[model samples]
Target: MRARALVGAALLAACSSVTPPGLVLDVGRTCEDIALAIADPDVLPGWKIHAAALARSDEDPAWYLASDNPDELALRRVPEDMPGVDLSALGGPHEFTLTRGPIEGQVWLTLDREDEARLWRVDEAGETMLAGPQLTGFPADTSTGWIRRLVFLGQSPHLIALPRTTRVGEVPVHMAAVSPELALGERWTLTAEVSCAPLSELNCPLLWEDLRTLTVLDVAEPGSVAGAALLVSIASLGEQPDPQMPPMFQTHIISLTVQRDPSAERPLLTRRDHVAWSTDGPVLPSPAQIAADPLGIYVLAGLVPAPDSSGANATTADYLFRADVLGAGTSGDSGVIALLGKDLRSHLLQLGSRVAIGQRTGDWWHVAPIEGVTIEEGIVGSLEVGDRVTLLRAGRGQVVVVGDAKPSRRVRIACADPDDGSETGGL
Candidate 1:
């Protein structure tokens, strides 16, 4: 009986995209059960009554829960309190069947062959299905030859093909195990490095072994290229070349293809060195941390002193620049670069459009503008080793600098907000 009901429900769900305006269900309600009830109302004569109770049980003043009683609770049903279910898990509820009920009483179910995960709706019309849990499975290993690398292109509720597979004109396949937490109209790409074994050890000896690159594409449409953001890049470092040597290692660069306009000549933008090693050793950056920001991605490459190197021993003049990502494919020298700061090793903070640089000479600590020029003198007062300094932008073009001084430590130049005009102070 359950088998027949499941099949019938599946057929009904496949046949229609619209659900009646007053049905509702819980977050984890089985589709097979709902289908049997929906297809033949007699199967569950009091299903609507149970749905109403469930709706009222989960009602909150913040949102309107679906319910059978429009006057008492309104025409919506409360969502069921199903543990371990998340809206992000449902993949936006595109393929589920919708039913309405109690104040928050809407229900949805997945037709996916893998799991019994179900989606819930807040309304009976099924126009808005809530998210559920993601199904899982091992993706088929379809490497015709030794796999070199894999890149992620775009993610959707539907399955996606691996980047290398797509390149070879193979049918796009998906790794059913990983489902991203994405919004509607948002896209993602994942690039994976399968292996880094040297092709030839006799002629060209490779320094590092077991290297890989993974690049992710968050947005791909041509019209949205500039707004497109990189989620993250993950790379694994090869073992240290020499245990006694100063961290020698090789890096595998992951490139991204930024899609421009569909009709434009060459809608793809590729960047090499998008992923690089730190000065210490070859280690890939974390993709989870990289994807957290929506504007741009940054990979820290350690500090480099200015070429002059004068006063470098006492005080180094280092400039921080964005790592070159164009690799060898760039032409005409128009590439991305970060700003330069005079003294960054001591105090370094990058927030929005401003960067804070701090320095201590004798008793006083001084700060300078990251961009424009400023004139300020040294060590007016003393400060303790662990004193905290906070700088706030003063009104009317004025700069406010605050210093928390420690005992026995005189006020040195605590903070510096460089104004266009000459400003001098002693604490």
Candidate 2:
């Protein structure tokens, strides 16, 4: 029994001493050496060790090292004169562009005295078309409720509704009798009057009471209902009353919900007295870029949250969250799956497994396992981990990991006694 106990202790000690292999490269190393290892002739093709090194090199250095070290530094210092890649040449609007595909649709805008109307649609070959100059008494800022279905409260008291659609002409809609909001397909329209009086003077004192009601006549529904739903989120702005002095501004999440109505003309959309999401305090600055996938909508906001705070004054941490229409009230779980520590600038390409996070304070990017411990250094360019570690190139990117790869387990034994080696042990 004592002999067995000794063998077990030895095995435990041996296992504990065997640390997992860490990053192969150090900070400040160039991509040339790491790339060479990936293409080495001596290393067996598809070997696990070689693959892991390659994987680590592909991620954005910033995300790879954010958790590894507390003191964040800049990864690469590109010269100001260096020729930067022009992403705008990739064939898309430099600013935000909303379209189902290559086709142009209808856009309606009304501001003060000018009511500009244009019809846009994409052809079968993916071409965009712009037509018309419609006029109305609605203010252009009021159209905020229309574009992207994202509400942006204007500086003035005017309410805007801009809904893009394929159909043209004035459709008989009695919105004043029923509700002041109407939802058609992916677009939602609001028809509300502007009030010069401050909200404090109203008897209700709440913005919801002052909203005008809108009603739609004949309505048609979309063909598919599978992934179609409306989401609504409300946030409050302004100062919280403090007895010590004047009130101070603080932002907070007020409400989030998802609705299943075909038109999305629920009662919640009529609340104009309340503040819009974009106007809420703790405002998130404009995002650098925005994209959508099966998972959710991603907005690459430039501001990065400071650790241990509710994102009041952190400059290094960028914010990424799933964008949803406020009235839709879809599941909260759907937005912003991963909050990366690095800035949006470091995220080169975010695909399945391979992600490139830019590192701080070095020419080389830090590469590490996407699922395991984060590695921050000045030498690595990109990092990935799967069946093996991999290092990505600065110019050439790597494939994203869509799923996990299981590793094969093998057992080996080394016996100290040659004579006793002949004895066999049962599996």
Q: Number of the top candidate by lDDT?
A: 1
Best TM-score among the predictions, by candidate number:
2
lDDT of 1 at 84: 21
lDDT of 1 by residue, 96-158 (tens): 222212123332223232223332333333334355443332233434211111122232132
Going through the candidates in order, what is the number of backbone clashes in each? 50, 96
Q: Considering summed lDDT, which 10 consecutive residues are worst modelled in model 2? A: 1-10
Please, what are the lDDT tens digits per residue for candidate 2 over residues 1-427?
0011100101101113333342222232222112211222122112222111111222221100001122221111011121212212222221122212110121111111223322222122222222223223322344322322212111101122323211111111111110112221232333322222455444322333322112111000111111222222222234445666643332211112122345645323311121122221344332233322232333333433224335554334443344333323322322333344442233322222222233222222233212111212221332222323222222122322211243211111111123443222211
Each prediction's TM-score versus the true structure: 0.30, 0.31
Model 1 residue runs over 4 Å out of place are 1-129, 132-139, 142-209, 213-228, 231-247, 250-255, 258-269, 281-336, 339-427
